[model samples]
Target: MTAADGSRLYGSDASTADQREALLSGEVPVAVYGLGKMGLPLAAVYADVTGDVVGADVDEGVVEAVNAGECHVESEPGLSELVERTVAAGAFEATADPRAAAERAAIHVVIVPTPITDEKEADLSALESVARDVGAELDTGDAVFVECTVPPRTCADLLEPMLAEEAGHDAFGLAFCPERTASGRALADIRGAYPKVVGGVDDESTRVAELVYGELTDNDVLAVGDATTAECVKVFEGLYRDVNIALANELATFADEIGVDVNEAIETANTQPFCDLHDPGPGVGGHCIPYYPYFVINGFETEAPLLRTAREVNDSMPAFTVNTLAREVRAEGGDLADATVAILGLTYRPGVEETRATPAGPIAEELAAAGAEVVAVDPLLDDADEFVAEMIPQRALYDPDRDLDAVVLVTPHEAFDDIEWERFDPLVVVDGRQYLDLSDTDHRVYTVGSGVTSAGRAESAEPHRDANLAAEVER
Candidate 1:
């Protein structure tokens, strides 16, 4: 078969249907490109299926780890053992060369990162680079599937033409299969939980792509209209999340002004069964939520007014957090210029080491830029001071003798839930994520979008007096 660009899309012997049947009968050669969080776990799944799985990555360390029967990315139970067994059986291997891997495999799954530029433009350099590499070595009948979050037209607009031009085919069998695997539970979700979305450049492409994914996942695969629609499905899923988070953030702010607890109200609202509301926090973070919408808006020239507004609201959260902390500092009779502020939580969210698009990084950088001596802490972060230089470990949040102007809780890590607020001699708490209980604390505590007052009798009288005066003046 050939693609529109006159390239041999797939070889006569490389049948996706045959591969699928072989996968069911336990005989398929699958190569997964990019060994980051998503690709590594996917490779492990194919490994478990006893299929010939080639894990390819540009990073030599990751490739070496996979070849040594070690999993580079953290995943669910039994992944290490599966990788080890697969390596021992010669069923799995890792390589840095894409062409070599492509030559040896009947199915290629591209899982490269599709991040956005500072101007909110889709940086398809990495994806394009991979496409060029794959195109140079693609054979007829070999199926190539893209499983990254991208704009609706990316696969058809960029990938199809690139592959066709590189391989000299008219219409190659190509498909877009967006992955819905959650970060932490990727191993389980990839194997069974989330259903797959498969869309092809044409009908034959769709069938072959479905066959490839069906072997690894037990969940149902829904075939969409075409590649563009499949691409939209991924972006829509993420944009939907961004919009809901913005709504929650906006409502949380309103709830604070009206003396209503947003969390409690959301709980009540969720009882209706149809109104499922996501919780608001310091802001939306992570790779997909923060970056994917920009691609959708930019790629399609679609007027996503609400989505655009939501992006603004979420992006502005860091500055808002810093401003809120500044107010708390002022309440303690201290200005940011001379105050030493301690920030709690550095990771974007809880329980993950991923810092991509993490709001805490920008928040800390902004605070430093505003002349505040910022000290950051996160339980998951070891050697935190070195990782970002401005951050410190949770245990070293404050020097006992040096009075802290404020402690900003940016991430709601469970460990922070039990902290004794009395430790800081003169502390003003800003709960950015609404994670802490300020009801019993003696320190004056303020939360993002929530007006929860603290009940604390401070040992230092002068600061408390100034704080009360500032509170009165602001009202």
Candidate 2:
């Protein structure tokens, strides 16, 4: 894959014709660093598209898994087959050594994690480590693209100068094209459900990126003015959700007092063009939505009162959910201190194995702290020891002889459809997703953001009800 000068034929300065031929003919080596959930699918897609790709990661386990033609990220449709085909065909390989991958590939893609620190600062350690390694073996005219979501100005200000200082000689491409994909739908999203956003440090860098992703993706490639703008584009997308979800959660509390069904109302109101409100749940979970607000809240000097407040509102959801459950349970003569509470779902998103920043963790902690024996049910997780909660198989949750108190449906995973609420017949069933139809059942049920039903109020000793909820329900 080298020219007469022993350099990559597809370096930044090669003529358009030569670069195009090399990329299309599988002569130019393409490397995707960070063989993770997002990175693996991206690497597979790149290999399937270019017929030559390498995957690099710090974890030797991931490297071994990939090289053996085995996939570590499950539930992503078509990923296993893609990985098998790519590995067997010799178009893809995984390595623990970043320098080896960097030295071989002309097009380097970095998709490492950019976790936020406890102080809310962007922890660019992984990104920087990969950058340093890639720079040490830097070649002229190579292109390095970062798909990791980062704060604004990270690509140009921090990454560009760092790579330049390391390279010292030949030029390479540095761009931030944030990986905009969810866990289950990564392959489809990357192949082309959405257009690719590419913003490079310079005009030439942008042009080179446009050429690469344009050939790789079925969708059009958008070239932004610079890298920071591209970073803002991704951050803005996440910030919008954080704020919208906070608004929904806030309205949910008000709905209980006013006797309104926030979920029903949200669905009805969303029929219009400009009204797309997110669902109100126990809380916003997952790595992206909960933390992206910090980019503005902590990174910038601007007064972001609303952003801060929204985070507070979302963060309070787990405890709020617990309080709601506790109130109903106490009204039924069951104390959370001795109650056997079942947390229905553990993952942040349904059908996905990721539990990063999931609300279930906090909810379980609060319940256990209150002296409740919490048994979490999620088919995706073998054991939830990380959350310090006991794991119970979903089918076993329906054992006729088992005794339980309250049931909190957190994630609304599809497997919960078959649960017989009466089997665990004792206290209240709180639906955080608001989609469960427990109204027909004999058990008292409370849907978050909705007023307690007559069925729930009937469980009380008298006609007495929660004062705030009394106005919304009839006698």
Candidate 3:
């Protein structure tokens, strides 16, 4: 396709103006496979931009939900309205048949999950299945792009050959453009907020993919050398953040050992022009930060010592939080074996309901395994069952009138800022995320990485709970 400025956007032998004109004229459709969190919003954005969009997924419930103008994923905002408008405009529809979706579109986008196997290997089963489905309806000039986060060379070395074998073609136009959208801000990010990176098997394929994304966003579209480079870009971006977080956690631990205030140290350090450090937390979680680095190391068979060590350091944080809680319980003269430990926050991070790779999961499991009566609560999760089932939702957590030994703050949800500190009567509060201010509170508060102490009753200062001293302790 050629632009009005006489610049040829695609390679010389690529699809001509006829295809572009057909697309703009609502003749050439766009299809998106795997209508999950990323895929559904991407399909909605495309439907909003163009008049023809088809969404396909393996889950019939998801397809039906979208078709009925509803969103099953809580991360998406105003998704129901978008789906209703698109469906009413006759520009968007969802189905379970991948082949049908592929046949109806000239450009196909795959946003399926590339999860890791039990052995920590790159599991390409979902990507391979979608490629086979797309190949079944692959035409000579059809353009295909993978928007999923994958390991280096995954698109060029693994997916390309798979698509070729399935489609019975020697070559096809294909590219890899990793998604950089956040969970809550996906709609805006996908629309035009961030730059788009396009890398393809050939110049023609790169151009085709760039033109496709260019139509959606006005942001800068960069064309890298090949799919391998594009894939590495995303991995590096995520792994770098993970390593930095690990550093923050390690420093926080040292601050606790030295009886220094970590928050003050981090604040002072951040004032320097060259320093851009993140805060320490209970643990690293979320779909991207915790898992993306492993994909690179596992797929490429390279020794990423720092990256692997960073993952381990972050992963070990929950256990450390648990151990800290146990120690505090003992210091408070309370035996954790029979104490009721209330956990605040279950989602991975704040302000969103996605719980994939949430650190709270491991923290809760470890707390329960340690023989504590773990009563978990989060403003996002409605009930204990739902919290145990989905681990995240929009409803507030239930607060029962029961005495507690300690409360662990894992996620710093905004709503938690409003909670009354007096509710946990005489409870020890362990601020894992540093979400609380305990300066004025009479209760004992222990913060991770912040070695601050508070005045406690004599019974609490002992090594175990003394029922005799409880009568003397003021509520």
Candidate 4:
């Protein structure tokens, strides 16, 4: 960009003072593409920080909902009210035309999903598609920020060239600022919590990204070496969790073998500062952990044997859970093929409605394939159309005369607490995530990660648990 253009736009002068004044005066307009779960909260935060913001998405329903001041996104705290207030104040608006929104806005942010293909390759199609639209409306010194979690080198090696080709101008600034927030606390994370990591294709792009985020977040903006490093930050975070959880799950398998309580050991071990372990469960789910490993596994030529092994360990959890279920059913003098099973919790996480890559789907499918009748229940999920299991509401789940051959606690939402678990007589129970205390129930229960068996609950090898109980009783 020429000196005159630098003086006119944020790319040229990304100083905090200049950007702050520009945002307040409505001179530097902001456009956020993708208005889904994370996108809407981010757009709302932008509106709260800046005076004017446009939210763009291909989904017409989302566009209409935002335009009508109704939050289509579900279960997000304070998001509906934030959207209503922002729309009411005219600081935020939703649009279907990305090109139009991009043209009018000086800061164009992309928060689209980067799903992995069936072959486990990173699917940048959505990100590429949005970049093309953003490029179409780009002008000299216009800033484009990618907030999608992507494989390293995607921002500098892929997006920069792609945007340039589409825009016919290499002058448009590009930055990679990975979205670090989860679905439940997106607004809070975006507003503060973790410091935002920003890296750009060039020095100018880096400066512009830092300036814009400095105004949007109350937290400090950490400028990394380049866009690839920023990409690495997000992917590494997910990768670490995936491997850590895999380790825990692997250890959980030893409970039955070693005849000891693994969770009790883990709980005691975690008291020390160095032993930071992820919880073991039916499986690791969600859009992030399960998919991010594939980013490295398939993106480049280098082999990720450890990552591949971790994926295998996590992927096997569903079947392992089913195996435990089958044993319990057989112990009760019945085969799994002839028994009825109830799979509880469909969402990957509790209190959130997101179902992307949730392990509950696989657990339900496996049970059905094993010839057992499966009924799935979750307070957050009313529709289990994606799976073969019969989806029932919480009320129907707790029928007084209900009897199932087996029950597998998959996601374990808090709503399950309302159910009188003692009301049902069961011979088989599989507690994923170790959410149940089988010692109190008559059924032969198997708690995942606790090393407990269907015959009896496992005992801890260490005296830490006993010490804690004694300490608490004395107090």
The model with the greatest TM-score is 2
Each candidate's number of clashing pairs is: 20, 1, 2, 0
Q: For residues 224-251, what per-residue lDDT tens digits would candidate 4 score against the true structure?
A: 9998899999899999999999999888
lDDT of 3 by residue, 1-475 (tens): 1112222223335356654555555665788998888888889888877678889999999999888877877756777678788878888889999988887777789999988888887788988898988988776667788999888888878788887888788456889988888878888788778899989988888978877788777798989998888888888899889999999987776654465788778979999999988888889888788888878677665688998888878987887777767767777678777778877887787878867788888877777777877777777765455546543222235464666678889888888778777665667778987778866777677777775467544332232124432222111
Cα lDDT of model 1 by residue, 395-458, tens digit: 3553445567777888777777666666666567778776787665567777766654657543
Give the total clashing residue pairs for model 4: 0
Q: Once superposed on the true structure, which residue ranges of model 1 sit more than 4 Å away at CA?
A: 1-19, 24-27, 75-77, 384-387, 390-402, 456-475
TM-score of each: 0.87, 0.92, 0.89, 0.91
TM-score winner between candidates 1 and 2: 2
TM-score of 3: 0.89
After aligning candidate 3 to the native by TM-score, how far in Å is the CA of 128 from where it should be? 0.5
**Candidate 1 residue 98 C-alpha distance from true site, Å:** 1.1
Per-residue error for 183 in candidate 3, Å, reads 1.2
